[model samples]
Target chain A: MTVRVLLADDEHLIRGALAALLALEDDLVVVAEAATGPEALAMARAHRPDVAVLDLQMPGADGVTVATSIRDELPSCRTMIVTSHGRPGHLKRALAAGVRGFLPKTVSAQRLAELIRTVHAGNRYVDPELAAEAIAAGDSPLTAREAEVLECAADGAPVAEIARRTSLSPGTVRNYLSSAAAKLGAENRHTAVRLARSKGWV
Target chain B: MTVRVLLADDEHLIRGALAALLALEDDLVVVAEAATGPEALAMARAHRPDVAVLDLQMPGADGVTVATSIRDELPSCRTMIVTSHGRPGHLKRALAAGVRGFLPKTVSAQRLAELIRTVHAGNRYVDPELAAEAIAAGDSPLTAREAEVLECAADGAPVAEIARRTSLSPGTVRNYLSSAAAKLGAENRHTAVRLARSKGWV
Candidate 1:
């Protein structure tokens, strides 16, 4: 039986080329394509594909968040995430969101097809190197809000800007940043951001 | 005569698929492929393709740097840059490096094929929106060393680490950082980083 799949990535070149390559496989067919997380979720709702292959970073939302939504809305549609940046935190997040497959953009087309089938069969598939790195990296000590604030601070935005972006008060943002710095044993928010980034935590 | 082309992108899937798709054209032939900027330069030296299509972001160096080298070493081979992130400063840098083409990764395969031909024919092509943005963004005020220091400081690393990374003394790093901040009218190194990033200067 052929596996119907939804492919979503922000890069039009990657998405189009990947669709063409996957079409060469006899047992796999791409049902739809999307260029963002929201579009991927919308396509999933419309097509009911057997598998949803999403890029980890997209405009509207991340692949993990989309996968979580798919899990809640379309239980039968197994989701997977592919990323050129296979960060440990991203891998952990995807697995937590019940993503059936986690692989790098460097994977061969044949291997990706096989993983798609594996995922369709209700089996989990993660790149072994990525999995090992995740184990070595350990879990992040920062809470969700702390991590989010750190990510906002990654661009070196001021506390007021971060607060505006997060829709939180400036005081709250400062508190989260301080707590994150403390948890990471950092002397300041800048150091905290650097530390979290090194661990793939933010 | 058919145009010989070299494809260089770190994303294996995108490169493989792009190579496969480009092979379908009658007047185009992919002579070699590489996954890094340095490797791209090596392949260009070996294959001497008429057109070298490179990704802007790669492991060893950037496409602009590679293009500059190719222009110096193999004057006959024209170069183009394809990027998912088409920053204004990057566009300016590529153009100054004597690159013949600048395009986003979202372009259609057929359009890319045409661009390869255009670049091979000694004509230039750039995405219009990117060009507009580049023009609007204006030139970066930072010098090469200042820009380098700002990029190093971007990760929130301490001055000592930035010095080690750049092979400069800590005082020199501090001087460059301060100069960059002053030029950008930023209060501190962190704010300077944010400003430079927004301007695509680093």
Candidate 2:
């Protein structure tokens, strides 16, 4: 089956260039494209594509949130992160979110196309160096749920509001927040959120 | 097929009560339950359910974003937004994201079950009052793409950055920002983003 793809990146210049190149593939079609996290999400909804190629940093939600959301809502459409900055923490988070492919932007368009196909076929591709580097850097102790909960509390929303928004009760939300804080050795969730954001775990 | 459901809500007290009630239905199984938006997403991945019953407000991501992500990636699993605040803009956004149902939290479990079954059957169920209110409130001038892009710019990302993030050229990004500003009659994209968010248009 031809792979229908959504390409999400903030770099419009590169995005267009890549989209044009990817268009030449016989088995690939760029069905939708987005420049920001929110737009990427909207396009994904509008397209329900076979695969999504996301950038790590966008104006809004970032690649991890987009990947997580898609994983939750669109299991059939596989996702991958294409980032210029291949931080170990980021790679781990993407993998935890069930991202099938992770690569640096240096890869040629042809390589990206093949990886998209692989992802659509329910396989995974991780940059060897990136994976090794992540291993060398050790691991982010926070679980996916803990990172997600901390990300939610990023805006300093009150615990009750956070509880309401996450569907986790106030106490459970606190537990996750505290756990995240403890894992990061931060004094509180605010510090933990900042730390996590700095590390891009969230 | 028996309906597998994921229930996402912050009110653990209510969530537990509802889960217990839902457990009574022989044809329906509460396969997973989540208390926060991120947890909901995680649980959905852990258990690919037939339907996701989501609260409108969750900590990590709102119900609409969650619905959009699911619709984009998980075509097989249907989604519904259960909100206490039935604002028209939110309803419209949810519907646009391919939410199969939108209802108030005041609904009885029996009624909620029926709606879930309806969604599982690939049908839609919007609360009559909510639908009317949305219609009465008229339409949001911004298209889904526009809303999404503006939402991306909410944090005051520059046009170039927004362009990069949205995959639009700088010119196109500017146009969208200007257009959104004009539509909202705001002085600039920043104001427009603020206005759109205030109205829940983004």
Candidate 3:
């Protein structure tokens, strides 16, 4: 069976190049190209491609969010995240969101095609260097809730706004913020976000 | 006359896409593509393209270094910098380096082609938003020598080594560092470098 693929990247050149590269595979067909996360979602819904190759960063939504949306809307279609920065936290979140493959943008065209095939065949693929880095980076120190609040805070949300976004009480949000700050050895929420971001823990 | 061009960027997809875009122009031809700064220099020397479009960040040497080398090696080949980040300091440095064109990566394919033509015709091009930002950023406070010394220091070199590299006496290097630190109101050399970098002053 032919593998249908959707390519999503903010770089037009990259999207065009990936599409051109994949066109060479005998069993692969390029079905769509999207320039942003929202566009990817819309194209995915329209094309229902067998595999979605996504760059981890985009304008409207990130790769993880798009992956989650695909998993929810098109359960059979697999997702492969290709990012320039192989942040361990990103890999972890992508895995949790049920993405089937993760790779860095530095990957060669041949390897990219092979990974697409692997993911399309219902197998998982993770770049060896990125997997090793994730292992070396150790476990995430923030709990699920703590990480959630920190993500909201990282968006520059105030305590009350974070609480509203997270469906938590304002007091609970403050407690999580304080706990995250203490765990990261940060003096405040802003420093905590910066620290976590540097470690790829946020 | 047909305007020959060279495309240099670390991302293979971007290189390919830009080449494809430029191929659409009747008067423009892409003569070479490079994935690194050194590769860019080598290809420029080899192809002698009329215009060189480069990404700001690449391995080995950066866009500025590549542009400078191209100026020295192939004076007729005008250089244009296309960057994802439009930091005012980047624009300042690029202009100082005699780069003929500065653009953000968000520019459309049409605008990019037009800019290429504009630059190839021996005219200057600057992204409007970036130009506005550079205007607001005003002038860099560090003297030319001080900025040069601070750039070396940002690599974590001591004053003596910086002096050797910049062809200045050790005491002169120390005096420059002290003046820079005082001007930036930084407590130490490390803080001074950090502050200068954050402001795009160094």
How much lDDT does each candidate structure score?
0.92, 0.81, 0.86
Q: How many residue pairs collide in each prediction? A: 0, 26, 0
Candidate number achieving the greatest TM-score relative to the actual structure: 1
lDDT ranking, best first: 1, 3, 2
lDDT of candidate 3 over A8-42, digit per residue (tens): 98876467656766787899999999999999999
Q: Candidate 1: which docking quality band?
A: medium
lDDT tens digits, residue span B1-202, model 3: 7999999988765676567667878999999999999999999999999999999999999898899999988899999999876678888889888899998777677788899999999999998899998898777888988888888877556677788999999999998988988988876665687778766787
lDDT of 2: 0.81
**Best of the candidates, DockQ:** 1
Which portions of model 2 miss their true places by more than 4 Å?
A1-202, B142-199
Candidate 2 residues B1-115, lDDT tens each?
A: 6899999876553465567667768889999988788888888878989999998987899888888877776788899998766778898889889998999765667788888
Ten residues in sequence with the least summed lDDT for candidate 2 chain A: A11-20
Clashing pairs in 1: none
How many Å off is the CA of A26 in candidate 2? 68
Error of 1 at A181 (Å): 3.4
DockQ of 3: 0.16
- Give the better candidate number (2 or 3) by lDDT: 3
Residue B139, candidate 2: alpha-carbon lDDT: 70
Best by lDDT: 1
